[model samples]
Target: MKTLDFIKLDEKSVAPVVESLKQLLADFQVYYTNLRGFHWNIKGHGFFILHEKFESMYNDAAEKVDEIAERILQLGGAPDNRFSEYLKIAKVKEVDSIACSDEAMSNIMQTISLLIEEERAVLDKASEAGDEVTVAMMSDFLVEQEKLVWMLVAFQSGKCHK
Candidate 1:
């Protein structure tokens, strides 16, 4: 007998989607850690502004971590919860504490670029698997992250200044 999740997605089709989601979960965890470090340690001219922004970002990341883990469980897969597992599978590495706001922003841009790539892959995989829920979630993430990436690039390039 073929096993199906509550949503009627078969385990066979859901397996690949779940795997991709797990990888995303791991990446989000690492990114969250880096953002927390940036929030606590950021300095220089934009210290207050950057610190607040990092806090907002990490808070959003924390919510995303929960959503990804829950989605894995909804698909009948165990979410990889260990830091060790995350470290092994995550492409986004743990960054050392960054005190420089510019450097931290640069790192954030790089991390977002990597995330956009990974999320697109997952979006494709989920679409292929007929997992509409995951597909929708990834699409939403991509839109938001894409905007953030655009804004960061503009800020970094001094294009944001009049």
Candidate 2:
């Protein structure tokens, strides 16, 4: 008899999605850390506004980290709980102290851009594997993050609310 992991499809097909999800989870952790830095270290002209925004962003990222890990478990894969492991697998590198609001915004924009690309790839893989739950989750993340990317870019360009 086949293994339970192959209940929905061949294990081979689901492997890529699981791997991609792991990487995405790692990236989210890095992003969360950076947002925390931004929230705590941010200073200068927009400190009041950006400090609050960073707090919100980090909170959202925290939720995504949990959701991603739970999804991995749902796929019959163990979620890596080690920061050391995440550091090795994550594409989004850890950012050190950054107090400038503009610099923080730029960092957030770049990180989210990379995250959006990864999410798209994961969405495709999940769709190909007929994993609607993963597909839907990724879709929701993409929609939200894409808007954030747009707003961050707009803020950088002075095209949005200052």
> What TM-score, computed on C-alpha atoms, does each candidate reach?
0.93, 0.91
Ten residues in sequence with the least summed lDDT for candidate 2: 1-10
Give the poorly placed runs of model 2, Cα more than 4 Å off.
1-9, 159-162
Q: Candidate 1, residues 10-63: lDDT per residue as tens digits?
A: 788788889999999999999999999999998888788788889999999999
lDDT values, one for every candidate: 0.89, 0.89
C-alpha root-mean-square deviation, each candidate: 2.0, 2.6
Best by TM-score: 1
Q: How displaced is residue 115 in candidate 2, in Å?
A: 0.3
Candidate 2 TM-score over all chains jointly? 0.91
